[model samples]
Target: MNELLVRSGGLYTTVQDTGRFGYYHMGMPPSGAMDVYSAVVANMLVGNPDDAGVLEGTYVGPRLEFTDDRMVAVTGADVPVTVNGESVEPWTAMRVGAGDVLEFAMIRSGCRVYVAVSGGIDVPVYLGSRSTYTLTGIGGHQGRKLVDDETLPLGAAGGRARGGAAVPEALRPALDVPAELRTVVGLCSYRLTEGALASFLGTDWKVTKDADRVGYRLRGGSLDFTEREQPFGAGSDPANVVDLGYPVGSIQVPGGDEPIVLLNDAVTGGGYATIGTVISVDRDRIAQTKTGDAVRFTSVDLDTALAARRDRRERIERVRREIAR
Candidate 1:
């Protein structure tokens, strides 16, 4: 029964849930929290369900004023949080009430942050999710990022979290390091010469400013394509393949140069020749990296990818248990 008044919307804050599913065939991307691990942990701190809607802040954090009492937590980045100008810790549940203003200082590390309140953000669901797909204006708080003075409604509180509930140090994510993404290379990788594939893994790519919800563009050493005639339906560009469904987290190099990592909000199908896919768990790692950061992709097998998926689930369970203690 509380309202969150957006005093400031920071850089690009959006309401996100687990994500929209089962619609990629129609070209709809699942627009959700880019850093699923951070989003889920933030919710865990506040006793919200893993898929509950939370605010995803990019770089800068939003300034919000609570209109009623609620429990809140911030996660993902090493940013300073405050209530009524008083410093509060991230990864810990804190109580807030009417007139209490939550603000963020400069981002010390990490690119995005997740904010979870007692009650999830109660935006109207679109396609079975409360995620915001800003490109086409669907779902979330009016299908866009929060702006100054916009009030967000909250549902019934889901947790009995009390103040001082802190996430264990080992359970929290860290930000100040080179980001590494585990990738499964194969689809259309034949387009790249053997040396190019090696270079792709050996190089440390720099994230470009053009990176956004849709996908991340990286600049590194050029990758060379193997000589071959274009396929029947494939485009003329060496990097082009027949238009096909892009698996979430797939990476495609255009002109055998910069690689693009498709994310949650990216087009489901494209003509680009995807050379690999970052494993599900490492998507969380790359999500924390901002423009100008160094990223290295390590090749892994499907077995390794599956193991990583399990490891991520186990880690989340660990957080849940620690919070329940």
Candidate 2:
């Protein structure tokens, strides 16, 4: 069978597609590529479906040897990629033969890198997705991060993939600048004092080491909550409220100090009072941010949020047209 022999599974490597849906009510978050735009572009470069399974490597990247000829593309992080010790440009599709080894250098900017192989990663799909949710161990390869010396199956490659297909520089997401996350200030936001809300938006929060697929914990300025009697079933902490469902991009400030931006693999519901939600498209910006990176939240209206999503869709469509040429 066609396969990739994992020489080293980097820091945290896993298989992920678009995401799993219809299970959030069961407390499962849609575990997928943190930078969906990058992941999709990687797949497109190799002529795979937009939601095709790809390898997501965090901080570091995996070393793998191909067992058959395949088309490959790497995206997301600004990391150096090498094929059999020779450097190669990222965001471009390249052909690899059996015995070809692929490797990555230390990340220069973004936290995660996506590798898309032609025919996609052939792992058993659970709940309509190949995403890995490591917390409960449900999907991906063995429901956890890939380990050293493991073998991953690959699907049959399609004939349409063209080597040397590259995404234009303008279309690629920028990794050099601090992230400015557009947020919709609403959900339970009344809990915060006026000064606290302003602080949350104005401060240049730094991403803490606790940032991951589940959530990104940030530290910058402290916030103050308006005093109120603790409601029944709610914890004594001022940031606590009776359990409420958390959207994928919700921001929750625990202890009125650090704010956690919940991501693809975050909990479905929690007692923490969510101050606002980062717009969907901006989640890609936050995903590329590494520890110590600065980020600021900008409050925007719902119409603006929807417009951003539309713009992203158009961008992806442009990529599709470009790669087809």
For lDDT, the strongest prediction is 2
Q: What is the Cα-based TM-score of model 2?
A: 0.99
Candidate 1 local distance difference test against the native: 0.90
In model 1, what are the clashing residue pairs, if there are any? none
Each prediction's whole-model lDDT (CA): 0.90, 0.94
Error of 2 at 113 (Å): 0.4
Give Cα distance to truth, residue 3, candidate 1, Å: 0.9
As for model 2, its CA RMSD to the true structure in angstroms is 0.8
Off by over 4 Å in 1: none
Residue-wise lDDT of candidate 2 within 85-109, one digit each (tens)? 9999999999999999999999999
For model 2 the local lDDT of residue 184 reads 98
Cα TM-score per model: 0.98, 0.99
